[model samples]
Target: MRPNVRLELIRKLMQQHNNPSFMKKIIVAILFVLLIVGGGVAYYLYNKGPLDVISSHAVEISAVNLYNSFLSDSAAAGKKYAGKVLEVSGLTEDVSVNQNQETIILLRTSVEGAHINCTLEDKTKVNANKGLIHIKGICSGIGDGDPDLGLPADVYLTRCFVINK
Candidate 1:
């Protein structure tokens, strides 16, 4: 039994020596793959930002675009993007107060008559009696809005804060 075990260990070492190229190739491939993945992760961390827990009562209209795109195509988005901090600039319209009595500032895309439906989750929907305001908030994204509402309501963030410019 001892002899057999020694032989087996020797066989393994011989097999490994005979396939040094194969092992080298595997190591190189793994290293290349790791570099690519690590670079991607580093880039994401540097550019996209930290993966901190995000909770906001208000967000911006850019969330509308993100949500609408997701709603227009649900399979394309994930929960990671919903109701996060945002910076958006657009023409404010269709100011509606939610059942919670929150103000949602509907945004019209800079394009002629291109409108996106949006709602505030915990925001105070100040009457946009003032037209064409820029918005920022904490938005919750739901599936796209129904056809009757038109456009999309992919994300709904309550107003944590807003800067009307």
Candidate 2:
């Protein structure tokens, strides 16, 4: 078409695109959607605890194997087991409560005095006996080893629940 006709068409398109009412409505809609989504995410994260965020399809392994994997290569073990639930079975070395009233069970492994520190979910429900126990928990990482005794490092598991006594 002619230059004048093209210029007029462009002007009309610009006027429609820059309409104040339409822009206001678009901005309001975007803001409303953002608010709703943000609120939903915030509420979900607030209600769900850290341990609950772990993957449901966990890798089941013995406590000794878990410890050995970490001892062999901590970075590789962390990549494989971190943020995943683990079902570990071993002898219960010690059972104690932390300051927050959380039950912590130390599961003995092949390494002497080195134990997997499993923090149970229910504080009042754990009645640990000195025997073999099956536990399901979220493996966080490896714990520091006993410096004085030269014991190997321990695997740290959180939100643990007794699977079998």
Candidate of highest lDDT: 2
State TM-scores per candidate: 0.42, 0.66
Instruction: State the displacement of the C-alpha of residue 75, model 2, in Å, after optimal TM-score superposition.
Output: 1.5
Worst 10 residues of 2 by lDDT: 49-58
TM-score leader:
2
> Candidate 2, residues 4-77: lDDT per residue as tens digits?
99999999878877899878888999999999999999999899866552346567798889998888899999
> Compared with the true structure, what per-residue lDDT tens digits does model 1 show for residues 107-150?
76433334544555445437666465555554455544456856
RMSD of each: 13.0, 7.3
The lDDT of each candidate is 0.57, 0.84
Q: How does residue 37 of candidate 1 score in lDDT? A: 100
